[model samples]
Target: MTTNATPRLAPGPRGTFLLGNLLDLRRDLIGFLRQVSGEYGDIVRFTVAGFTVHLVTHPDHLRHVLQVNSRNYDKQSHEYRPLKLAFGEGLFTSDGDFWKKQRRLMQPAFHRQRILALGEHIVRDVVERVDAWQPYAQRGESLDVAAEMVALSMNVATKSLFSTGLRGDEEVTTIARNLDTVIGYCLYRTMVPFAPPPRVPTRRNREFTAAMTSLDGIIYRIIGERREHGGDTYDLLSMLLEARDEETGEGMPDKQMRDEIATLLLGGYETTSNQLSWAWYELSRNPDVEARLHEELDRVLGDRLPTVADVPRLEYTNRILEETLRLYPVPWLERRAAATDSIGGYHVKAGSLIYISPYLTHRHPDFWAEPERFDPDRFTPERSADRPRFAYFPFGGGPRLCIGNRLAQLEAQLTLATIAQRYRLRLVPDHPVEAKMQVTTSPRYGLRMTLEPRRPAA
Candidate 1:
């Protein structure tokens, strides 16, 4: 069924003469992508300042780039350079043999057993955080659900990484504020091709440098304390310190440890918080789905907090998370062709930028029935059996998949179940929630919602 004909460029929008599609892309990234993918077929070729870029939305093509011929495409693209400014050469930004070794050392810490054991900590944190919302529910005051999720997720990340939460509210607020600046700057740099380099003393660069410095001070201080008073601990930091290379039998260097910790903090909290925020947004809009979720949680969990063993039984809750991811996949994947290649009969030249958008692909009409509709039942085993493997890849696919995927899922499932057991979040009327593309897909105006207390099913 495959074609071996001479390769040609894929069809795409004829962009502006000088800047290509840069203006349209900057104007509205997700909308522009959806527009083009709807008009053109799967492999849409566009130019940005004469740089050839291919937006591959087909599942088969995505598999070819992310899995089948993964070695031919790598993270050496311009997309990841901004990330390296904050993450350094950590797992998120590293490649080749160095990446392989790092993955090996960190793999044991993320094992299923280890993650399951962390469920107690995750649930406890979620319980404390959600309980604090009682005042909001009692007074019927609207709270920014987006900001709440971010703070809660950051607390969970710190607990998991260091086995302790931030020292106090002020510290947590400071870290979260700085992270916003850092992430916002990185996103601006990534989207704006002509952005000034970090070395230049621009206001953005200066702010980014200050924010990174504050974050590094915290990270290195943790590393330094661990080294001074080393002890047995179950946290990720301890594991990283103990991890030794099989070949060289060496522990991670301080600089590398800082980089990895920063990467984990950035990756761990941001995506899950955004996903949870979106889940609340959708549940408020779809009462039936929300009702079913509550029914399942009540039937399975009764009056007790959810445990790791109960995750499988909470099928509907997990499905809600899956559905949310389908609609709002955070990270848009980018890779560069290390060598000349062919994709769907299109000749992809060496060094060409290959863009595979999960946001677009997840909603591909060919694969998803009523793709925009929020339906958790679509993920049932019977329904999902025939779907393309690469079609629903929110955590991405293949070897370079997001390392903390399982941990993120567990945290989300547990947090959602715990909070839904106590209260239901209702979106504020006419709040105008819109998906904004940044480092992640998040609400442009933070999700403001009021909470209603739910009684246990008798």
Candidate 2:
């Protein structure tokens, strides 16, 4: 049934003859994308120096690219290069056989049961951290909620990975600081095409190199220490160390172990933290939704900290998180280099690039009602049942769907529910909310908010 009609060129804004939409894309990626999709229908083609970039907005089209014919789209996208430099050949960066092997070895750690079992530990970390925030609440202090979540998520992720929390760990602190430097540097280069190489002896290059060296030193130290204390343990570190290929009975090499752990550090905490930050921002902006969330938490737990068993009952809380992700997905854009394919009847020759944004696709008018508004009920089972499977993929889809998705959900839900049980966050008056797009979507100016202790459910 395939038609031989040549697909019409995707509509987009006219830019300088040679640059096409490159300037718009680099200047304001989020706003530029919204403009393109808003005006140009579902598929947008923007040519940059003779290179055609396709941004697919429809759910069915996304599924085709991410799930159905995913084999034709490898992880050789331009966006992945910076991440590959940061993470090396880890599960998040590798492809084909290597990715498959790493994914298999790590799958058991993130099993539903295991993720559920870790709920108590996650709450304990949240409780410990939030307890300290109480003093600021009492003093009416405005705190950077985004930074707070980053710190909290780092502790949770590290604890989950190593069975040792990062609180009071100077080495981890230094490593995290350097990771920030590297991520910011990489993001800038990705957007600004003419940026100099990292090898140049500029101040920025030196900083990036120093950060990478510091990160490497800390990671290698941890790996060496783990090797010295070898024994079977339930943490991800031990699991990775002990796992062997079923056929060859070979374990992951030390370098791979480091890569996977680094992958955990980069991907694990960053997205969940950003998601929670945006969730709080949305909650603060919508009092009615916040009230409903509180009511749900009150009815579900009645002052008890949320457990994995209670997550299903905290339906509204989950909805808020879902809605937040819809508005601001962590990894906003997914890029792939097409390997001889066609999308929406358009011939996608080899070397062509495809861009899919959960941030944009989740807000596509065809799939979402009032796409710009914050509406948690949009995620209610009845409402969501009719939507295409790819319409709401915060964790992505298909073989490359994020392996840590279940764990992230459990972590976010538990953390949000636990905090909602005890505190309500309010944004500082006139504080502007803006997204700073990088590998993850973060608040441009950190979300500044004051905490108010909520009354216990009667």
Candidate 3:
């Protein structure tokens, strides 16, 4: 649609005298975004320290911004500056030819067939972790489900990236811890816009630098070791090691490979782990849904574990994961700036930031009925047929959509099915579960739950 006249200003809540909406955004971003989406219309325009910001909730607008005219909206927006700090110009941060080249090199590693092949590894990781959970179950010990999922996903990530388990590998564990430290620091930096620069010798900065140093040391050590022992390895590192640019017929540089691997570890592990943790939280609260999930698992696998082949038949399990993603997507908010254009009758000037929050859109009242309810059936084919594709973009949409989407889904589905087959994770009574918005959204207090071995199906 074209605007014949000057476009009206998009409506939004007024902010404080000088800071604009900066404080509100920093305080409770998710809650503030929700209020703004409900109070203002689909395209809410707000200001942050005099810069215009637009929050887009409608699907058509999302499609237009993300897919149809994506080139105009680049990833170099200020919102991604923190991530760029942590990951450099890896696939998660790069744009243009650089991004395309990296994507091409990394594409083969995350192909559907390749992702499917990794399922056995994923299941093995899940089974090993679950087998150990029996001791906690027997002792009536309360396990932090969120931490458990983190460990599980971390194992799966290391195995996927290095083709080896990291259970007792302190060097790799140090790398993982350092990555978490960096992620935490990045989250802090992203939230507090006025925070001191990293180069400053502040306590946080020093810790962040130390973490980066440790992380770099581990990643470089692994790269050097892989080069020394390089015959053929099926891990993603090996794939990157061997990947060649079509034009130059040259392999990626060590720096580039390190960035990609670091990006994959952060993306692959944190998002999947958070989602799986949230899934357990939801399942514990919703017994009916859990019952249906169990019924599907019982009917499909009997006493055996879930494999890649069982992914399709575990329809309800997949729906449960889909619903969990709808509620608690790890990357809850995304930002892009208009290179140039108009959207939904609003004149989006060049360099204005547009906020595309799947968290808000997924729970949009207009799109989803009873938006707060946790019902996995919302993802059933019949129910899902009527919604716009952009209305539920958990992995996002368009070309920059998450490269590991299929792998994440496969891993979560397999992990969920495998665990549900053997044990039930129930939340501890009166335990508070709050959403913590780090670089990825996760449980605030961590999900405290007790595990019980499920009786065999008769």
Candidate 4:
């Protein structure tokens, strides 16, 4: 019995019979979690609907749940099953051989060299979009970077993964807007973890399904055309189509193809875009940091777009993104279900779920000094080297680490270096930056700012 060998962590109070901690999640997700972690110690527990979820705060415990004891866990059907209804067996919600197979198939495509080949597209998009803001910059007009950040990142992912650009064409624009809505709705509802499948008539459900339909139609058409036309290309779709398991040499089926594309659709752009949006917000508030970023960009990149080779040289840009991920990791929480009964000083029940909150670990006082401040130096080469391996995991750790990790990093560093080389963004006065618990941690109020083109480098 669970009561007999009581685990060190125990469930604390949640809420009344009617509401649950739903109010905390609704009003301010990150703030509420921070309050709970500060009040409770490293391993905090709570109950909702007769279920217990443990929120692990300490970095060591985080790795214990996410990395060390990773094998003891699966993605769990609660998180995996509903997503399967839409994404099917894609990497984001898959386990066992399906995830293993997909990870192997797609890993080669994101190799540093292969991803570096996508750099030109990264520069062109960052330049065009950031340059398009010139008029606003010239007129001293403010911009809400929330949507702009999405547009910027969508362009990067669209270019790298889709191997196409987003023109202002009616159909492409419509499908993108619709697709974003549907994906957001489905992902957010997965929080409940046990709801019945959303039906066609539910407004959000309809949009998600409709958007998937429209987009899938387009992608399938493209694949068909590519097959017929038969040109050599290096995009992710092409890689997936051609990749063979190193040992078995088998490829994914057509149905799996849709899932793979849907995986990138749901998992790719939002995380990096939100990260950049937050970086923009953080940089604007901390002028000294922004100045240091500008100095690094000017000294390293000047006005020319940074190539992938310039990535390591643009150290500050990398650190800014690092700091951003620390504060607003796209995945605020990651969960795992125990696959085996295990004992140490503690026992992990086979069926129990473990929740690891990076949001809390990154801010915990035991590890980080002045944990709330926006300090890129926290991730400096020397400082970060001294920290524990799992202390700063913006990307989830272990083999199941994000497949798109390199591609995302390549995009963020190049795009930030590219754009920051071109303009200085000033947070507009009194523009409220509030958090929203969306598919990712997002800005509901929109991050508004004024943009001014940087003077040309001598």
| Model 4, global lDDT | 0.74
Best by lDDT: 1
Error of 4 at 268 (Å): 2.0
Off by over 4 Å in 3: 1-5, 165-167, 456-458
Q: Each candidate: how many clashes? A: 0, 0, 0, 2
What lDDT score belongs to each candidate, Candidate 1 first?
0.89, 0.82, 0.85, 0.74
Model 2 score (lDDT):
0.82
lDDT of 4 at 342: 39
- Candidate number that wins on TM-score, 1 or 3: 1
Give the local distance difference test score of model 3.
0.85
Q: What's every prediction's RMSD, in angstroms?
A: 2.3, 2.4, 2.2, 3.0
lDDT of 1: 0.89
Question: Which consecutive 10 residues in model 3 have the weakest lDDT in total?
Answer: 164-173
The TM-score of predicted model 1 comes to: 0.96
Q: For model 2, what is the error of residue 324's alpha carbon versus the real structure, in angstroms, after optimal superposition?
A: 0.8
Tens-digit lDDT track for model 3 on 100-146? Answer: 88998889988788888888889888878787777788899998989
Candidate 4 lDDT tens digits, 76-110:
73545566767778888778776887787888877
lDDT of 2 by residue, 325-402 (tens): 998895465556556677887666777778888888887787898999999999998999999998989888889898
Q: Rank the candidates by TM-score, best first.
A: 1, 3, 2, 4
- The model with the greatest TM-score is 1
